[model samples]
Target: MKLAVIGLGMASKPHLAALKLLADQIEVVGLYSRSESRRAAMAAETGWPAFDSLQAVANSDAQVVIVITPPNARAELVQTLGAAGKAILMEKPVERDLARAKALVETCEGFGVPLGIVLQHRYRAGAEALADLMASGRAGKVLMARVSLPWWRDQGYYDTPGRGTLDMDGGGVLITQAIHVLDLMLSLAGPVAEVMALTGKTPLHQMETEDFAAAGLRFENGAVGSVVATTAAYPGGAETLELECTHVALKLEAGALTLHWRNGQTETVGEVTGTGGGGDPMDFPCDWHRDLITDFAARVQAGQAPRVSGRDALRVHRLIDAIERSARTRAIAQVEAEA
Candidate 1:
């Protein structure tokens, strides 16, 4: 499979490395980035052809296009690729604006293009085992779900342009850093019916969006949930998701899972380390990205929907939107029905 990448930001590096792992099956044909210098640097470093414009990349023979641009800058480029009948794989938080995200999903659907989001947590071994256990009905119904992502980001991290802005990277913590845990929570507990949240910036960071967030959630399955996310936690801590079912309590810390059953039995499953809680934003390993990208390539070859399709990612976006709205309105926000 021939592929093209459309951003040379931090995400592009891991993605390129992961694509290399699948070199026997896939080849990166071209790259495009708005920053000429960055593109030149990437080209010099990787020996990959760098296109001058999005149209040039779109016009290439690449069958799949990977978009690692910021959430605010994704729609137009994605729409262009979709119109050209190319499969698109986009980074998380499909769009900063919920309405625009919905429009992007619709655009892909209108053109019959397959759109996938890089929610790599879903491809983790522990998460996969947990999801399997939940689906097998052996774990019983989930009673309570909770997620905590107490990560740290120094002020300098946000000092960069468009770091935590509402117009660029989208909402902080909840949308940017914690959305992976939030997506994992949704996967384990099912859809959230309503949410009440509060958001605020910490003294540590001077960005426009919140560095801290807490929320109360009510799921459609009668499961109660809670979320606490903050970049203010000193030195950061592990990102954890816990699900209490009638018979078993499943806890996932980073990418590892531990199950405590009602019968006094405990078991650990899967292997993968947590991303850096040491205040480095780019500290994650690219193994999960490799798995996700490989899966996308196989799914594309089979003409099937990817594991985390655009429609699938829209749910997480809606949840984030609801949390932000609830924070602003100081009232419980009902999650909009899926489009």
Candidate 2:
């Protein structure tokens, strides 16, 4: 498929790498961003041609357009892409909040274009195994789940204007960093029905949004779970999710999965891989991104549904919204009904 990328920033590194690896499946014909300097850097660095203007990108022959801009700057860009009849693969959180996210999704739908989101954590080998088991009903009903994102980000990381602020990147920990794992968790365990949360900022980072969030989740399937996501941990550790099912118990940490069966036998699948949960946000490999892009390109050609479509991504966004609501009201908050 012919493809192009917009908003060539720090977040575009893995994507650029992924596009290179996926050269056979996707031809990255052009790159664009508001800053000519950034476009120059990307063109010089990756040898991908730079589009001089948004109109140039819209007028191009690229079938798939990857929009990797910050959360605060997406609506108008997506609108333009939609009008240009370009299928979009956007970076996560869709927008600053759920309402904006929904409108963005509608904009793409109005163009009758497929919109995919880059929640690549769901493409990990371990996550795939667990997801297959869940769909197969071999693991039985998940009775309980435990999720933790003990991530760290030095104050300097958030020192950039609009880094941790509500106005720019949305929320601090949950929306920006933890959203990957949160999306992975929801994809594995299904939708959350309700959440009671306590969220606030620790002194470690002077930010506008919460750096720490702890919540109790009640899944629509009658499964229960706990979530502790934060960036306050020093030198962050690997994020983890544990699911205790009727047939067996599974633990997925980093990129590996361990199954503890009823017969006292245990087996592990996948090798441990860097999660980028620590200091360096781009520390992880680009393999997962490659896999996700591979699927997306195939689906785009086949005229099929995306593995992580924009509307489907709303599951995690709704869960995050409920968490913040409960954090504020100190009461149980229900996940919003999906359309």
**lDDT of residue 300 for candidate 1:** 94
lDDT of 2 by residue, 92-173 (tens): 9888899989999999898999999999988889999989888998888889999999999898889987898888888989
Best by lDDT: 2
**Clash number for each model:** 0, 0
TM values, all candidates = 0.97, 0.98
**Candidate 2, lDDT over the whole model:** 0.91
Residue 136: error of model 1 in Å? 1.0
lDDT of each: 0.89, 0.91
lDDT of 1 at 147: 90
Task: Name the 10 consecutive residues with the lowest summed lDDT in model 2.
Answer: 270-279
